[model samples]
Target: MVDSGVSAAYPIIKNYIESLGRSLNDLENILLTHSHPDHIGCAAKLKEKSGCQIWAHSPERRMIEETDLQFSVRPVPGFHTLVGGSVSIDQELFNNQEIYLEENLMMRVMHTPGHSAGSVSFRLSKDDALFTGDAILLPGEMPIYEQVDEYLLSLRKIDEVGAKILLSAWDEPKSGAEIPSILRASKNYIEQIDSAINTTCQNGKSDNPIDFCKQVLERLKLPVPLANPLLVKTFQAHLD
Candidate 1:
């Protein structure tokens, strides 16, 4: 499994895996995209049932290996409810690293940070498919990244890959010409959020990040549910 969904998705994922004619015990690896609770929620359970060796970047290792520390510091909303638990990473991944699943089948790790310090995307060398996990969110989605600059740079890196198949965690799989279009659109959405931030605080952004996030969301006419501490942190990235 590339990235496990929420804790509630465990049985669903397992059933799907079984439906494919493979038992959970047959699995051997769980490659993480980042350390976000939602992204790594069912990881622990998956690893436990399958004896899979989990792989994650060094920047995210601490969080992925220590759920208590993550909750104590970040304290994301519904953190405890969402995350199944933490599990140790068997191998540390890095930029340009190639992982062979089997003979003639390979996955190239792309260190596409920004969504998080350790965020990564994987490219299936044999099939030319890219599995981008929350690295390229669409316009209607809530913006949640650590650094706007890094996110933009990562987007450019993803574009350079020129993969024929673009499989994002958020959006439907896109292909061929649609890949670049979606990437460019994702970049533009970030730019739009940047502009909204500026417009919301035309008098200069407030020192209070939470308030600033609310103002920007109001300016964008985004849903109230989107206003949260993570979104606040995302807005604060521009200030930094």
Candidate 2:
């Protein structure tokens, strides 16, 4: 599976596989796009049940093996503490590395770090698809890149790939003429975020990132609980 979802999702995955007359053990590899709890949550459980090898970018290996590393940066809410558990990485992927799935099927890894330091996107040569996990967000969603410049570069990289199908962890797939718009929207969103930060600064508000993000959120009419922290992080990236 591309992502394991949350821990409670294992049973659902197993059931879906069984419906296809396949066992969970038939699964051989779990390729992680990043080490986010929602994406790598059930990896350990799935590995225990199906003996599948987990693969992720080298920078993400330590986080997968020691999940506490993630929580240390982004503290987990009490309700989500059980969402993810640590798992050993059987293979550490690198940029431009090709993973041969079968005689004719192959996937190329692309190191598209932005949302997180270790974030990556996968390119399926045969299918002409790119699986981007949080490296790009849909329009209107909070753009939370740790490094704005890197994020812009990654978006350019995606545009250069010209994948027929664009798959993201949070948004529906885009294809054909719809694909370029995603890249454009991502870049435009970053510009919009920067503008918001600039406007906040012009208003002579507290220069504190948290306070600046609150004004930006209010200006954008976004909810505080959902958009505050992410905007603050994005503002910090701008500062950096």
Candidate 3:
């Protein structure tokens, strides 16, 4: 599987695999797009049960193994309990690295760090599909990043791929003509957020980040919880 959903999702994944006439043990590799808890939650357990080798970008290896790196938000209540435990990466992936799944199946790794320092996207050479984790979040969903430049660049990189299928972690897959628009929309959303932040600061609405984020959220018609700690961090990243 490209990215395991979460710890609670293991049974579903295993059952799906079995439905395909393959057992969990039949799986050999788990390619991670990032080290986020939701993305990597079931990796260790899957690896333990299936003896699958977990692969992730080198920068994300430490975070995946140690589970110490804080990407966007500080751990809130039940954070550890909800995110589950960490897993060790068996192999470290690099940009442009080609991973062979079979004689005819190969995937190219792209370092698309923006959402997190070690975030990555994968392009399936044979399928003409790009699996973008949180690198390109859907509209109505908050996009958090530690670096704005990196995130923007990553979006461009994804666009350059021109893949027929664009698969995102949080959003439904986009194919054909719809794919390009999704990429453009992701970039445009970030730019709009940046502009709003600048305008808010210039108008001297609220200097406090929390209040500033609220103002931006209201202006954009996004929910408070969505903007609070998540988009708030994105705002902070831009300010920094």
Candidate 4:
């Protein structure tokens, strides 16, 4: 199977794979997008048992070489940790490189960073299916922002690729029709940051970025979670 092995994202994937009744030897070769545990967990253990070759970005080779406590936890909610294990990659992918799978299936590597420095997305030129690791999320009315600049660049790159289908790590299949809309929303969200900074400057209350984001959330019609401040803090990170 062309997977790093499921560690944190969902063990159900591994359960499902095992449930298929395929002999361990039947599944071979794992292509990883990055070193994230959810994507690369179970690689070493699976490899030891199944003898599958794990291929990932050259930088992620270290992931399999050792395991860390940091890689053991889900960075955010809607994510989970995989069992402990190290992964070793047999191959490393580079940008703008193409790997032909079958006559109809080939993946063109595109480095779409920001989520993680080495994060990447793969495009299927023929089928037009793009695997966006975590670069984009399904439309949530308001666009979530990363570090602003990097996130914008990644969005522009997605437009440049012009895939018919956008597959994200979090969302379901999306049509090209939603691309421009989400991009616009993402831009609008960025603009709100400017407004927040400017308002803070004018009011001399620049110290409270959280309150500024609360105002922005209301303007954008986003649900402000009362249980935790993490959601608010995440938005504040983009402020100037």
Please state every model's RMSD to the true fold in angstroms: 1.3, 1.7, 1.9, 4.5
- Candidate 4 TM-score, C-alpha based: 0.69
How do all models score by TM-score?
0.96, 0.93, 0.93, 0.69
Candidate 2 Cα outliers beyond 4 Å, as residue runs? 78-82, 227-230
Query: What is the C-alpha local distance difference test score of candidate 2?
Result: 0.83
Q: What is the Cα-based TM-score of model 2?
A: 0.93
Model 4: per-residue Cα lDDT over 60-118, one tens digit each: 46654555643442243432356446666677888888987777678888887655556
- Sort order, TM-score high to low: 1, 2, 3, 4
* Per-residue lDDT value at 6 in model 2: 81
Better of 1 and 2 by TM-score: 1
Each model's total of backbone clashes? 0, 0, 0, 3
By summed lDDT, which 10 consecutive residues of candidate 1 come out lowest? 203-212
For model 3, the local distance difference test gives: 0.83
Give one digit per residue, the lDDT tens place, for model 3 in 1-240.
898877888899999999999999899999999877788878888999999999999987877787656433355344475455778888999999999999999999999998988999999988799999899966656656778999989888888889999889987888998988988888888888888778877878786777888888877778765545666777889888
lDDT of 1 at 201: 72
- Give the Cα error of residue 115 in candidate 4, in Å: 1.1
**Top model by TM-score, which number?**
1
lDDT for 131 (candidate 3): 93
Model 1 C-alpha RMSD to native: 1.3
Candidate 1 lDDT over 1-240, as tens digits, reads: 798888989999999999999999988988999998888999999998889999998999999999999988677989988999889899999989999999999999999989998899999997799999989978778888998889999999999989989989988899999988988998988988888987877867767777777788877778865678889888878868
